[model samples]
Target chain A: DVKVTQSLRYLVKRTGEKVFLECVQDMDHENMFWYRQDPGLGLRLIYFSYDVKMKEKGDIPEGYSVSREKKERFSLILESASTNQTSMYLCASRSGGSYGYTFGSGTRLTVV
Target chain B: SQQGEEDPQALSIQEGENATMNCSYKTSINNLQWYRQNSGRGLVHLILIRSNEREKHSGRLRVTLDTSKKSSSLLITASRAADTASYFCATWANSGYALNFGKGTSLLVTP
Candidate 1:
C-alpha cells in the first residue's frame, strides 16, 4: 500500500511564529501537493511540486510557500502564523500523470 | 477559481435508503472523481468517471456524467451507517495539472 505521512497530526503555534509542516511519501511519486481544508470552502490547493526543486503556486498560495529538496519529502512553510491560518492541512502524492491522489492523515494547525 | 459545486450541502437518510449527491462544474474536464472523507481524516477515492463515459458503477455506487451540462452525480444504494461521510466531487480540467474540488456534501446515515 502507498503511504503518505505528515510530521504532525495536531499543532499549536503562537501568532507571528514561523511554522513548518512536513510530508513524506513512500511511493516515490513524482507529484506532491499541499492543501488547506476549511469549513464551507472545501479543499483549496496552496502549492504543488511535480519534481524536486520545482514548485507551482495554486489558488490560495498567498500566505504559504513550499520546499521540495528531496523527491520523497515536501514541506509547507508559514512565514508568520496568524489566526486566520488555523485550519486542517493535507498532503497528497501521486505517480506520474495519475488523476488519483493518496492523502496523508491531515495536520490540524491552530494559531493562537 | 473552484471548478465544481456540490448540491444539497447536507443530507440525512435512513440506513437502508439510497443517497444521491450532485456536482456541477464550469469548464471542460478530463475526468470527474468522487471522494469520501470522515470527520477529520484524509479523503479516500470512491469513483472516477471519464468525460467520454456517461455512466459507471462500482459495487453499490453509481456515477453519471454529462459533458453538455458539465455535471455529475453520485448515488449510493442500500446505504449503511458506516457510509456516513462527507462526499466531495473533484474535476480534473484540461488546462491544469491539479484537481479542483467542490465544497462537499455531508451525508448522515442513521440506523
Candidate 2:
C-alpha cells in the first residue's frame, strides 16, 4: 500500500510564530500537494510540487510557501501563523498514471 | 475554486440500509472521485469514475456519473456503522495537477 506520512498530527503555535508542516510519500510519486481544509470552504490548495526543487503556487497561497528539496519530502511553511490560519492541513501525492491522489493523515494546526 | 458541491450536509441511517449522496460540478472534468474521511483522519479514496464511464462499482459501493447534467451519485448498500464518515467528491479542474474537492456530506450509520 502507498503511504503518505505527515510529521505532525496536531500542533499549537502562538500567533506570529513560524510554522512548518512536513509531508513525505513512499510511492516515488512525482507530484505532491499541500492544502488547507476549512469548514464550508473545502480543500483549498496552498502549493504543489511536481519535481524536486520545483514548486507552484495554488489558489490560496498568499500566507504559505513550500519547499521540495527532495523527491519524497514536501514541506509547507507559514511565514507568521495567525488565528485565521488555524485549520486542518492536508498533504497529497500522485503518480503519473494514478487515478487520484494518496493523502496523508493530516495536520491539525491551531494558531493562538 | 471548488468545482463540486455535494448535497445533504448530513444523513443518518440504520445499519444494513442504503445511503446515497449526490455531487454536482460546474465545469468539464477529466474524471471524478469519491473519498471517505473518518472523524479526524485524512480522506481515503473510495472510487473513481472517468468522463467516459457512466457507472462503476466496488464491493458494496456504487458510483454513477452523468456528464450531461454534471452530476454524480454514490450509493453504499448494506451500510455499516463503520461506514459513518464524511464523503467528498473531487474533480480535476483547469489545473491538471490538483483536485477540486466539494464541501462534503457527513453520513452517520446507526447499528
Maximum-lDDT candidate: 2
Quality of candidate 2 docking, DockQ: 0.84
Highest DockQ: which candidate? 2
Best by TM-score: 2
Tens-place lDDT digits, model 1, residues A1-112: 8899996999999999999999999999999999999998999999999899999998899889999999999999999999999999999998885789889989999999
lDDT agreement with native, every candidate: 0.93, 0.94
How does residue B97 of candidate 1 score in lDDT?
Answer: 70
Provide the global lDDT of candidate 2 against the true structure. 0.94
| Clashes found in each candidate (C-alpha, N, C closer than 3 A) | 0, 0
lDDT of 2 at A62: 90
Over A17-105, each residue of candidate 2 has an lDDT whose tens digit, in order, gives 99999999999999999989988888898999989999988989998989999999999999999999999999999997886889999
Candidate 2 lDDT, tens digit per residue, B15-111?
Answer: 9999999999999888999999998889999999999999999999999999999999999999999999999999986868889899999999999
TM-score of 2: 0.98
- Give interface RMSD, every candidate, in order: 0.7, 0.7
- Poorest stretch of ten by lDDT in candidate 1 chain A: A93-102
